[model samples]
Target chain A: MRPSSAERASSGSFELFAWLFMRISGVILLGMAVFHLFYMHFVFGVERMNFNTIGARWQNPLWRVFDFFLLAFALFHGFNGLRVVLDDYLSQRPGWRVLAKTLVFVLVVGLMSIGGYVIFTFPAAANLAAVP
Target chain B: MKAHFKIKRFNPEKDREPHWEEYELEVEPTERVLDALQTIKWEQDGTLTLRRSCAHGICGSDAMVINGKNRLACKTLIKDLGSHITVEPLRGLPVIKDLIIDFTDFFAKYRSIKPYFINDEPPPDVERRQSPRQRARFDDTTKCILCGICTTACPVFWADSRYLGPAAIVQAHRFLFDSRDQGAEERLPVLSAHGGVWKCRTVFNCTDACPQGIDVTGAIAEVKKLLLFRKL
Candidate 1:
């Protein structure tokens, strides 16, 4: 392998983007989380958060989009933090690292699909009850 | 006592690829890993080649991959390593032959950090006086003896040989915190360049690999913190 210092520094945008993502998304997630907590706890109050209120809010696609971004960002931040551990320990074993990464990818895909389906198809309960 | 050693060997002049050779040997409980290698080279086989200087761990010349960890052969007791030992050249650099590795890239990175005391002041009759507290600032880093174990064991350096590895950061820390040195400001941007302190993933592999027990990771963190606050 060509061991030039100049080449590798320029070839590392993936790592650069990952580093920037953590810091920027952390700031964004903090604001979003604070706004969410205020809306849930102070503005609406805990007692008012019944299924009716949540279901009414879920009727808006904007709310779904908001929750989607929150889930995506939070998951990315937490998983990228876990990547530090994997990079340290698992990289020593190439085969194990590959398996670990594949499992993590599958888990993220499954969780995102399930969460998106639940948020978008809330009214599917009505169709289930009338099917019989 | 007896221990099994599996050493990675490659003779570039004769062999096309590297391979491992296993040897069973008798040893004393207090014998260092360097003594074990000496036995192998003197009695078992003369073709084995490795580097060792002080044989007491002070010279830092005998650092190698032992049991998948970077350590000084003269410091590691055979008893502490258990009955099995896997010896190999330090990773991340090209191996020259047997257990010796080419340290050109490692030393180049160290040089990039300017691992020397630098001052532009005119000399007085006496030496540059340093307070006890001022000397303590970079004390942990001063113990480094230019061993490439930390740099070679680094997985980031293994992935991209270009990245200035942890040893370079420790050297930078030494000069960066020196009260008599007038090069901290100059060294700051040099370290902050393309493959600077930002590349550290904080795996702490460097900290783990240091034979001198220096907190290499902590020094790198302090450097990264300087990037924001610009303090000593």
Candidate 2:
């Protein structure tokens, strides 16, 4: 007896999920990126931003949440976009694709980790005051 | 000047076999390949079929394989090639007729990337401010004429039609690098999916066949760097 169609289709959901993820992530980034620009560039003028300004913002739990969202969304968005381009052009050689996506995942994960850590353990304003 | 041209012909409705038809033409050395083709169609054989419009390279209407490489017939000069030339429709695309390939799949892939600036907020009444240097960053990628040369030359797309290909990637790169474009965050993950930028093998054939000399591999590399590093 031949194997059922459902069995074959179920095995390929990983690829289907990847495609669906692109559409979903692409939509989410559309909104998050807009909000990000509004907060960073328009809400407070670019000239007014500095280390202290960022430090102050990071001190707030709400802003920390904002930063985390930004980091995650931006990294995923950028990575997924590159993934599409790579798949389109590099599908012939499995070895090359594996090596390239591995590097990409590593770099995105590293940046996300650093950004997340900075947001999480931000130095308190009192610490800055005590230094002087 | 006398020139010899060999063209691949296959008429599915009439002929069961694919064959090459030869024609001789008298033309100036500086004349383009399109000119010779025109001579053959008008003087020697009316049955010959091909697609063309702008006659200039801009429309990307006359892309074909010339002398074993993909190129725009309108832009290639007889002086640059030997007296003998072979012309055929671009490889890797479904041939709809003589020298015309089905572009529906190609355009669909291009559209999948959402190749437009997506700023949900209303635009400012005044011009959006961007420094000249910011504009310069993406200027090279903006020159793509949607010519299928890069996509057809790509081995990845050759095997899998679902892959978005280089021309679309270059288009994505244009918006990805643009300062005014607010969709980078959304565009990236979509581009990074299964048939996305992850598939590029970097053979550099697209770079060689590009008439505008855009660094396609370099742009793909830049996209990879941005995706990996999460920043420029």
Candidate 3:
């Protein structure tokens, strides 16, 4: 028998979108992550990444947006992959699967919110004296 | 050459759990594992049990774990497997007896894909026709023999039985890519469902396990691509 409308609605195209997001976000993440590390480590210099440097970079909204997307895509891509892992390992254990998935969901949301807030709302200008 | 055969055995009536039984046999290097098994059953132990038909590997009835790999016993040459050979039933399925697994779920998954032609426009003067290119698109998946090796070899299917498994996706690909098959609309939803193509992790065990060299994992990726872009 076909599933009811409500039941079908729950599973509708979410996995498809999730699967696509992994591939797309994976590519985006690859470029963003490599550029991030290269820019920070080589051009910007790891030693120069003090609070004042970050404060200066965040003065530009584009940097904040880039950081936000970096955080979001990495989190979604990673947690969705984790969800697949949970589905694989905990399949025989229903209660644990639900609890673990819920925990991962909470972590993704909580971390995204925290990371987004930090990226967008951190003090735009750091007191130069505080760096030392 | 003298070979040591270690077979996993279980008797539901007498044994609570499966155990290993070993036999020593002299055999030619060119002889297949099936020959070694026949010698063991015929000369050493009559109770040794296995399923085989068309003993040349086309029937796909004798898929088992030979030397820790999924292979057709009839096709695996004893020379390839070292002196110590271990034969076990295909993993992730209930072993009905020694070297025989229950294929009820495996075949059911195959049938769930609607593995037949489904064009409904009906009655070309003779039969539906297709160009060579179109026929070649799905020719790789046409070699599937419904052997449980590919499905049982899949880690996803081993972990979750609900996952349609690689064999099912390959079967679906056989029809879904057919230019004459109207079943894509029917099969795509089943392939993209929760435990459908999405469950494939692309570990490539199915491709490695396939006796027919069906490119099982590649077929699954094709199905996923079709579902994603809705293009050929």
lDDT of each: 0.81, 0.81, 0.87
Error of 2 at A118 (Å): 44
Q: Name model 1 segments beyond 4 Å from true.
A: A1-21, A27-132
In the range A84-111, model 3's lDDT, one tens digit per residue, is 9998889789799999999999999999
What TM-score does structure 1 among the candidates reach? 0.72
Give the lDDT of residue B223 in candidate 1: 83
- Model 2, B1-232: lDDT tens digits are 8899999987778877668988888889999999999889899888788889999999998999999999999999999998999999898887877788888878887877779988777889998889999999999999999988999999877876656789888999999999988998766755665556656768899999998889998998788667756631
Better of 1 and 2 by DockQ: 1
Tell me model 1's lDDT, rounded to 2 decimals: 0.81
Compared with the real two-chain complex, what DockQ does model 3 have?
Answer: 0.40
Worst 10 residues of 1 chain B by lDDT: B223-232
DockQ category of candidate 2: incorrect
Which portions of model 3 miss their true places by more than 4 Å? Answer: A1-9, A126-132
* Model 3 Cα shift for residue B224 (angstroms): 0.9
